[model samples]
Target: MVRNPLRAFFMMLGIAIGIASLTAMSTIGESTRQETMRQFKNMVGNYDLINIEPGASATRGMPSLTTVEPTLKFGDSDAIVEQVSGVKQVADVQNAFDLNVKYRDRTTAAAVYGITANWLEMHSYFIDFGSVLTDEDVASVARVAVIGPDIQNDLFEREDPIGKQIRIGGVPFLVKGVLVTRGAGPGGSSLDGIVFIPVTTASKRLFNRDYLTTITVELIEPLNPEPVLQEITAVLRERHGIIPPGEDDFGFVNPRAAAEQVAEVDSALTRILTGISVIATIIGGTVIMSLMLIAVSERRREIGVRRAMGATREDIMHQFLIEAAAASLVGGVVGTLLGVGGGVIAVLQQSMPPLIVWKSIGLAVVLSIIVGLIFGLQPAWKAANTDPIEALRS
Candidate 1:
């Protein structure tokens, strides 16, 4: 390497780029997968939670926007709590979107949901300050409201939002609490840009509807939700007077089903990244092999000198192979550092949580070594087979 610095550097560069690209891809992919799982956990609260909504849509990504009369209702929530054997909690939601929300001099359009008091607990949300809605707030059709962190920042600035009145849909609502920051939910939608009001108040005053948009159920044992799901389906079917042969008007977002969907997407992404990494490493190895063959030709006289001094063919082969392997091994080390830096930059650009998968770095090193051995063999063999008498003449 010292004798031919430029050649060694160029050979190392090829491997460096290949390993770096592979490591960066794997790191970014792992981070994205973790972030996706976390977002789903936030939306669903627990693995045992089931989100049920009325609609005929084939997709479970979002609840169907069905009419109030034929869809889920507040009554379904009561029935689910009473009839389901292993039920733990039922949270009913009635939401109206893109509403004109106002507080003194600030105004913004946001989503609003009328929710039962236990909705916060079921969804794993906590108040940063003040208090969450109580049963009394839902029962008396109180005009109290809880706002998310984004709403807090936009409306109140440094002023305290607690005890302050905000108007939703032209009706006065007292701000009871401010929710902690929740960055995004499904589909990258903002979660902190919503407001929560009492379910009764939402039905009677704001939207003037007695139907529910969704019912989120938390069960006692989450390991197997089959029996609970069946019970829920049976109860709703009976209440709606639907026959078994006909398609039901409602759909369910089962935790296991949603998890499978997430895993599928993650798997597809991993395959694409892994394919790219393999291609890069192969190209890098090919470059190294080509360079080594050229080096062998230039150093033929050196090999002859060693052979003339009693160096065996095996010795020549081992020297060249070891040199090639060393280049790739060093490159792998440098690439690991570069890859981590690249991944951090990418994640920072998107404001995602930072995480490093050390396994990817180890894999890069191991794979690079393998590439060195595979591609270096042919050049080493050719160097070893050279005749000492012919080489000295050259």
Candidate 2:
């Protein structure tokens, strides 16, 4: 290796490339998985929460302002709470999109939501100022509203939003509170660009419809949501007069199921990338074997001289094997440095949360050494089997 620097460098380069790819891809994969979960949590609250909507195609992960059909009613929400066991809280939701929301001279089109008093708590939203809606407000159909941070910024700007009146589709509503900033949801939708009103007020005053867009349910802690979900389905099916094998008008948006789906997709992608890296490592091993064979053929006379000078077959084999392992070990160290640098740059460029995987780095170094030993076997055998008398004559 010292006499032929170029050959040694080429042998190390292949192994380095393979190890670098494996380490870098594994680091990126873990970061992506965590990011996916964060996005899901932002869109839907927790694993024990489920949203039931009035259409068969409403198995969405995020809340929507529009519905395909209007079959869900306020009574459905009441029935779920009364009949379904392990249910902690339930809220009926009504939504209207692209409504003109105005605060004095400023105006913008935004989604308006009408929710029960427990809705904010169910969705894990905290009020930055003032207070949430009361049951009395919903029962009496009061003309009051809660605005999000985006709405506050768009309409009120520097002025105070509380106590000011905003008009939603030509109806005046007094602002009661402002929600804390939630940033963005799935698909970059603004979670704070909306208004919240009492469900009764929305049904009787704003939209004038008895149908609800969704029924949000929160299950009790330490309880399995599957049983509660089945019970809720059975109750809805009976109420809607649907028999077995008959198509139901309602669908569930289960947060747990959605989260599992995201996890599965991430896992599959990681497996495929890892497989590709393994293939590259194998190809690198093949290159090492081919080059070592050529070296053995060129240095047959050296083997004969060593043998005549009292070197045994085992000694000859060990020398070649050690040389191969040394090259791979050096390559592994270099690859690890390059891989870590690449991963850090990727996180900085994408502005993603940083996550370091030390286990993967350790595994990559081990894999390189194993590849070196396995591929060096054939060449080592050829060098060890050389005949001293025949080689000296040649």
Candidate 3:
């Protein structure tokens, strides 16, 4: 192997390309799955949390915040809390998009949400500083606001936002708290560019409507949302006076169902890519076999001389096999390192979390060695069977 530098490199190069592709694909697949779940959790909460939006079209996706729907009401939220058995907490929500938010001379557009006090907790949000909204704020219709990190930066900059008054749609509001940064949402929208106010204040003082945009429900027994879902559907249908065959006025977003959909898509893509990598590895093995056969032909004289010198057939075969395995092993190690670096860069480009699957790397190295032994068998046999008398005469 040391004497034939060019031949050894070609053998190593083929295996390296295949192993690199396999390892990198495995890393990317795992990272994508994890990142998708995390992003979903941030936007949709857990399986235990269900969001009910106005209009049947919401079943496909979240309803537009700008779409004016009068079908869902605040009473529906109260009824769910009182009537639904497995219900833990219910928060009524109303939202307005692209509202002009101003603090002194600074201004920016943001999504303003009118929410119950428990909205933050239900959505897994925490206050970075100051305080969250209280029941009193909603009841008394207090003109107070909680700002997101992006909102704080765009309007306040170096100034402290807490206790400072900011204007939303030209109405003055006291900044009660700032939320911990949530970064970008699942749909690539900015989650941090938002403002929260009491639902009552938004209805009476700002939008002046008697409706809600959505009702988010947290369940006690999350593993089975069917019973709770049925009950909620029944309550809403009966309250809205919808009979059989009538399309319901509300839609449900089940976090678990959404998660399953995402997993299916990711799984399909991963399988296709993995199959391609396997084919490449097989091609690499084929290349190794072809090259080794050529090497055996070129070195026929060496094999003949060794046989004349009383070197056993088994010894000649073993020597060739070991050379093949050594080349593959070195290539595997190099490929694994390169694959990990490539995977990290790919995930980072997609703004995904970096994750390494050590199990896959170990398996890839083992497989490379196995491929070397299997492909080298034919060449080893031919070298071992070379005749000595004819070669000496030549």
Lowest lDDT sum, 10 consecutive residues, model 1, at 57-66
C-alpha displacement of 162 in model 2, angstroms? 1.5
Q: What lDDT is obtained when candidate 2 is compared to the true structure? A: 0.84
Candidate numbers sorted by lDDT from highest down: 3, 1, 2
Ranking by TM-score: 1, 2, 3
Q: For residues 329-356, could you state the per-residue lDDT of candidate 3 as single tens digits?
A: 7888888888888998998998888889
Task: Report the number of backbone clashes for model 3.
Answer: 0
TM-score of each: 0.91, 0.91, 0.89
Q: What is the C-alpha RMSD of each candidate to the true structure, in Å?
A: 2.4, 2.6, 2.8
Error of 3 at 378 (Å): 3.0
**Model 2: lowest-lDDT 10 consecutive positions:** 58-67
Candidate 1's TM-score: 0.91
List, residue by residue over 127-230, the lDDT tens digit for candidate 2: 99988999999999999999999899999999998899999999999999999987766555777888999999999999999999888898895246667777
Q: Per-residue error at 380 for model 2, in Å?
A: 1.9
lDDT of 1 by residue, 1-394 (tens): 6689898888788888888888888778887888888777766666667888777643444444555344887889899999999899999899988898999989988899999999887778899999999999999999999999889888999999999999998999999999998877766777889899999999999999868888989989867777888898899989888896877777787765786689679868976987887798888899889999999999899999999999999999999899888988888788878988898789778778767888888999998888887888898998999998889999
Candidate lDDT scores, in order, read: 0.85, 0.84, 0.86
Top candidate, metric lDDT: 3
